[model samples]
Target chain A: MKKQIIYSLKSPYRENLDVIGFTFGSGEKSACIVGSTRGNEVQQMYICSQVVHALKKLERQGEITEGRSIMVVPCINYYSMNIGKRFWTMDNTDINRMFPGYEFGETTQRIADGVFRQVQGFKFGIQLASFYQSGDFLPHVKMMKTEFSQPEKMLEFGLPYALTRKPRPYDTTTLNYNWQIWETQAFSVYSYGTETVDEKASQVSVDAILRFLSAEGIVRANVKPGYVSRIIEENTMQQVHTEHGGIFKTLVKIGDTVYEGQVLGEVYNPLDGEKICEVKADKCGTVFFIYNKPLIMQNSVAYKIVDF
Target chain B: MIQTVAENELSVNEKLKIRKNTYQNGKGKRISIVTGTHGDELEGQFAVWLVGDYIKKNIGCLNGTVDIYPALNPLGIDSITRGIPGFDLDMNRVFPGFSEGTMAECVCNAIVEDIKGSEVCVDIHASNIYLRELPQIRISRDTAESLVPLAKMMNIDFVWVHESATVLRSTLAHSLNSIGTKTLVVELGVGMRINKDLGYQLLNGIINLLYELGMWSEKPDFEVRQPIVSFDGAVGFVNSDASGVFVSDVEFGSEVEKGDVIGRVLNPLTAESEPVKAVCSGLLFTLREYPVVYGGSLIARILSREEEN
Candidate 1:
């Protein structure tokens, strides 16, 4: 196992920001995994760190396949992470949105360009992604439904669910989308949390990556066979939104099987604690996501359920 | 008369409403003015008020409909955020939006539908708080032939014909232009604050544009300055070499020769100052508004005259 600095930016007043990648084996760049482009994505970063640890152990035990290399970039925006900022601290720009970046562009673009140049040509790209909305997602592997996308390959992760999302206009700039466009089979792994670390979910994510590597002949480790993932279209998920903005009290957890007209949560008036409205499930399905935040905005998606 | 362009219900029993004020005298060409797509960009707020007030006071000068759509992202404006407050999404990046999409997309779709067929539209904006931009109309090269002529009459200092690759396809201007609306994006001033002079300058340009489009009956008293059109000019970007509070030595929008001292990055603890110089002789259209700088922070962008020549 070799630890290498993939990209570095010299800071004038502070320590230079370095994007470090941990590589296992040598020869073909078989797979690359990235985590936590945003600062607050602690869980995503933690999962990558665990993957690196597992890969290091596997390589030491000669389990890593010869003539095949895998790269794990645990965290990219550590400068922002150090300051607890969600985006680039200097400009508040998302590095994740500046993919296939320009060398002569702004600070984020340069960093993106530098990083993308290093990670672009890998056979497979996996990103431990965080949701735009602050919530908990059921552990799954998601792929952008681009021309280069192969949804069947996502099942190799052996996660609970494999999701395929249609690429939107804003999605074209993302790393996962750009990777696929560049002919790399890209997948986005969504674990349980972003800011907070979920031990169970992190273990599941680490195990899933190892399982995939073993299956793909990148590594020769004996890992437990995970779930046969159910393929689902991202847009097909039933979104349950709250009708009132207030203190949210969730009655069901993620992965709970919910029935139609079942009360999933309740929005209470913040000032008086009066029940303003009940957020009931409109479809019978498994709860795939739950809003973890205490304060709920009206029309905000409180829960997302995948129909049975 | 005030009209609601788009409306969406928020969680707190309140509504996200995009309103526009219309001034019409008779049947004629329609012109639309859009502003406040970004909540933090307050320069457009002043321009919207000024234009709406002017049209109201001088209703006699109005020959056709003048639609002034202000505060496209009202929640962002209300919360003083660059994007939609709860969604954490940039309102400007979801243009030509999907009707069956998220709330932001639906609102954007409605806005696009409402402003689609106008003869001419001026979308106003201000730079982020970190940078101050001179009054400029930024047009993509693809639409430059048609839009540049209209942009010149807007009375802006610079008509920047940017390469189409640099323009985001999802931007309101790009989205509207793709659908055949003659939309011109006007960017000026700094974020979070109103620039009255720049606002009035844009207002005059809009008035001049109204007359040029045959939407205004009377000629305005103000004289519009012919803008410097940057079709082939390369923009010189000046980044800071040292991190500290930047103190500017030159004013924004001033022409400077190559190697000219634009600013100094001062480290107070060491009392050391590093000079930031110009890379080319050009018009400094963009300058840092926020003083804080890092090693790679952008200090200024100059429109190079060498390429133009």
Candidate 2:
């Protein structure tokens, strides 16, 4: 295993910001995994660290395939992470949205350009992604339904579910979308949480990545064939939005099966603690996502259920 | 007359609404003025108020319909956030939206539908708190041929014709232009605070534009400035090389020569200062407003006179 500095920038007030990558084996750049481009994605970063640890052990045991290399970047935007900010601390910009970035552009763009230049040509790309909203997602592998994307390949991760979403206009600037456009099969692994670490969910994500690597012949390890991941389209999920804004009290968690018209959560008046409304499931399905924040806004998505 | 453009029921008893005020005298060309897509950009708030006040006082000057759509993102404006408060979505980035999409998208879609078919539209904005800008109209190259003539009459200091690649396709201006609304994006001042002078300047430009578009019968009182139109590769970006509190020695919108000392990055801990110099000779149209900056923070943007020639 070799620790490589992929990109570095000299900071005036602190140590130089460095984007480090760990490489295992040599020859073909078989895969690249990135985690936590945003600061609040602690779980994403933790999952990537575990992946790196697993890869290091596999390499030491000579389990890594010959003439194949894998690169793991555990975290970017550590400067923001150190300060507990979500985006770039200097400027509130998301590095994830500056893919195929400009060399002469802003700070985030330059960092993106430097990192993309190194990670672009890999055969496969994996990103530990988190949702924009504060929520918990069922562990899954998601792929953008681009022309270059092979959704069937996502099933190889052996997670509980494999999701394919049509790319929106804002998605074109994202790293996962750009990677696929550049001909790399890209996948985003969503764990159970973003800001908080979930040990069980982290292991699920780490095991999924290793299982994929072993299945693809990049690594030779004895691992469980996790699951026959159900193929799901992103738009097909049933969303349950709260009708009132107040304190959200969730009755069901992610992965819980529910019937149509079942009460999933309740919104209570913050001041008086009176029940404002009951959030009911519109369709019978397994809960795929749940808003974890205490305060709920009117019309905010409280839960998303996927019909099996 | 005031009209609701879009509305959504909130979790509380209240409702989130986007509204427009229309002043019409007769059947003629229609012009629309829009602002407050970003809640923190308060410069536009003053312009909206001033324009509405002027139209109400001089109703006789209105030959056609003048639609003032202020606070496009009322939720953001109410919460003082750059994007939608609860959704964390940039309202400007979800343009020409889908009716079946999320709440933000539906609202954007309704706004586009409401503003479409106007002869001309002026979308006003202010720079983020970190930077201050001179009154300017930024038009993408694709729309420049048709819009530059109209932009020249808007009385701004600079008419920046940027490459289409630099323009986000999802922006309100781009969306409106793509659908043939003839929208011009006017950016000026700094975020979160109203600049009376800049606001009045923008109001004058809008009235002049209305007069030029045949939407206003009476002539505008103020003389419009013939802006310095940008040519290819005319804008020079100046970035800071050191991170510290920057103290500017030069005024914004002032002509500067190449290598002129515009600001200095002061490191109080070490008692050291790093001079930030102008990269090219031109009109300094943009300057850093916030004092603290990182190594790569943008200090200023100079519109090169030589390149324009």
Candidate 3:
């Protein structure tokens, strides 16, 4: 196991920003795993760190297969993380959206360019990503519908779901899309939390990565295959929106299975504590997404369910 | 003529009103000048003030109408914030906005709708807080075909033609172009503060553009320098190797050849200095003004006329 500085930038006030990567084995560039691109994505960073810890142990025990290498970049945007910002602190720009960045562009673009250059050339890329909105998601691997998307191989992670998403306009600059454009099959592993680390989901994410490495013959570790991941299309999910803006009280957690028309949450008027509306499930399926913020705005997505 | 484009009630005592000033003599071509899209970029506000005064003094000489929408995001400027204060959203990002959407969206929608049918639109801006920039006119590919020639008539030093596909579609100029308005974005000075000289220079550029477009009967009184017309890819970025106080050796608009040291990143703690060298021969249009910079931060942007193969 070798700890390498994948990229570094000079800072004026504090220490230089360094993107650290952990490598296991010596030869082939088998897989590259990126943790959090945003500072608020603490869960993503924690999960990647756990993966690094496990890979280090596996490498020490000679479990990592010869001539197969894997790289784990725990955190890419540490400068933002230090200040608890979701994007670049200075310009308020998102580094995640500056994929295959211009070297001479803005700060975020340069960071993306430097980081992407290091993570490219791997056979597979996995990004422990989070949603833009504050929410809890059922742990799953998401793949963009690009030319290089390998949906079948993503099931090797053994997560509950392998979601395929169609790219949006803003998604064109994302690392996941650019990774695929560069012919590296990329997958975004979303856990249950972002700002706060969820232990169970983090463990699931670490285990899933180990399971994938083992299944692909990159590592010879005896990790258990977690689940038979179901292939899900992004459009198939049912979004539940709130009708009234008020204080939200969620009754069910993410991953909870619910029957059709079941009460998922209730909104109470802030002025008087009177129940404004009840958010209900319209489909019989597992809860895929749940809004974690205390306040629910009118017409805001409160939950998403994966049809059974 | 001054009229309100958008008005939103913030409180009983205060209301946010986006105003537009029009200068007209006879109907020919309508030109719209927009600024203050981002509250922090105040250089455009000064340019608008100067241009509004110019148009007012010479209103009788104007052959067509000139519409100037200055301070588009009043709520943002009121609090000295970049985005809309409560929404914390960049008004520039929600272009061609929805009429029935949120406050920022409605504001954007109103602005887009009003400026969509203009003969030409010039969106003015200042660099963000961190950098100092030389006055330049930026146009996308589709806009370049029709606006670059007019952009050359402006007094700015650089005219950058970027690929339209690569530019963000949500920007005001992008949305205006989508609706068939030939738009040119003029960015100058720095954010939060205004350079009087650059402000007057860009103001003159707008007047010169108006004169060339036949909106003004007389030639613009300001001197116009031939601008370096370059593609977006012709700009080169110089990044810092070490994290430290960036003490620039050269100022904005400094001309440097390849391998010249533009600045040095000095580590105040270690007292070590790392020199940042220029990779291409061009004029430095952007220089980092805020000294404290992180590794990978753009220290300078050099604009050259070299065509990318």
Candidate 4:
């Protein structure tokens, strides 16, 4: 195992944009984990805990041995993290979008360069994403759309749900999205709903990683493999946007089966005491996620009803 | 035209000077008042000048020393812009500014210092050109309770109670809270013009505000109507998907009902009109003066509630 230090992106008003990564093992096979991609919560803390947990589980095994090494770069946007903002406080840009990372670019692009060097990889890249508001994840792994044939790395994680998603416009240049393009198997874990840190999901993710290592030749252990889970496609997704902006008071909970035209929540207008908004599912499905923010603006997301 | 300002710093907008005056009945309350934060919203700056002229002509209204950073971002005033000069930064956003920084930061730091010692601060503003906002005093309900009752006296149309966002980097009035200063935020009239009526209204409001607090002996006449408030109060937007003369259905301040036709987005090419309606009932707070519309241009903001007696 080896330790390395790196500088962060240089923004106008803040510091701590620096990052560091630790790698273990050597040879043709390697793996990387970068969490808290978003400067807010997903990275650097809760998800970082999951990776630390995985590393601890891997340590007891005689697997990461003589030839293989693992690298971990947790919480890249320490400057934004310091300010408790979602973007670099100085430039207000997402550090995640600066990929293939730049050396002399904007504040974010510079940060992109810092982590890009750490994540160049040997075998797999697991990026955990915590949903905004209240979308409880079903323990899914979003496999590469084109690289579905290489599900072996992901399947070894042994989670209940592993669905593949095509990259969205705002999604391109992302760690996983672009990583998939280079034939690097990438997975975006929808860890848990927004603003929440669940212990259960951590255990699920950590257990999955240990199982995956044993499944591959990395670890010589009693880990079970080949007991693959269900694979869902992206076609079964439906998003619901609230028509009005106001305090979001949800009436239904996640994991609740809902039908088309179901009342998900109400937006209360403070101008006059009234419920002016009605959110309904357009198709029969199950509720997955909803926003935690009550004071929403027009066109802000309200909920996600996955059509079953 | 550069002049060495206080403590020998080069000041921008060589055309203007830091007009210092205090309003304390010989007792000195250490008051600071600023206006024209946004160049386009000139009513406040005009009102400040009017008041400033009166103070200069006679004795000061302030007890302690007073500093007036009128048009703090002078370049914004020259270009009629909302942001500070050079960096396109909103001067209001960069509060407690940095010393070794952009021009905007330099000015902001200066303003914060100018009012740092003040016990009561006031930041004045103006509405956009198309709409008329009734003269009012805006007080941060989230701050100390000492300023609440005074805010009630501003005699405006609405006393908005809003939560603080991005603290320490809030509005000028909001920033004053961190320094333990009681601040009042006032806004009225259309932007860029001196409405004689609004000008008079604002001039009198400030006088009354200070007089009530014992800064002045005379009272500024206040409007008779008690203000109104709502949550994010009454945001009613009327827009035309079709272009034409936007014939308004109701006057400003008129009560509307759900599904009521508030106006029409008319297609002048075909001489046909599409009804511009209100999906939710509310009061008509603002309307577009220019009748012609390019698709998606908003015509009005209705403060939604149709219940009018």
Best by DockQ: 2
lDDT for each of the candidates?
0.88, 0.89, 0.83, 0.61
lDDT of 3 at A64: 89
Interface RMSD values for all candidates: 3.3, 3.1, 5.1, 24.1
The runs of at least 3 residues in candidate 1 whose Cα sits more than 4 Å from the true structure, single-residue gaps closed, are A243-251, A258-283, B9-13, B269-273
User: First chain TM-score in every candidate?
Assistant: 0.98, 0.98, 0.97, 0.81
Shift in Å, residue A121, candidate 1: 2.2
Report how far off residue B116 is in candidate 1 (Å): 2.8
Task: Please give the range of 10 consecutive residues that has the lowest summed lDDT in model 1 chain A.
Answer: A9-18
Q: What would the per-residue lDDT of candidate 4 be over residues B229-258, giving only the tens digit for each residue?
A: 543434545555554567777776677786
Q: A1-308, model 4: which lDDT tens digit per residue?
A: 45566554322223324576666566655567677766566433566556655565566554465676666666676565666766555334455655765654433565676677668655777676655334344566767576433654566677766676655433556777666665567776666543456676665665665566556566544544533666666546676766655666888887688887888888777556588778888888777666665565444456766655
Candidate 1 CAPRI-style tier:
acceptable
Q: Please count the clashing residue pairs in each candidate, in the order shown.
A: 1, 2, 8, 31
- The alpha-carbon lDDT assigned to residue B90 of candidate 3 equals 71
lDDT of 1 by residue, A205-278 (tens): 99888888888999987778899998999999998877767889999988899999999999988777789999
Candidate 4 CAPRI grade: incorrect
- Give Cα distance to truth, residue B167, candidate 3, Å: 5.6
TM-score of each model, paired residue for residue: 0.93, 0.93, 0.82, 0.47
TM-score between candidate 2 and the true structure: 0.93
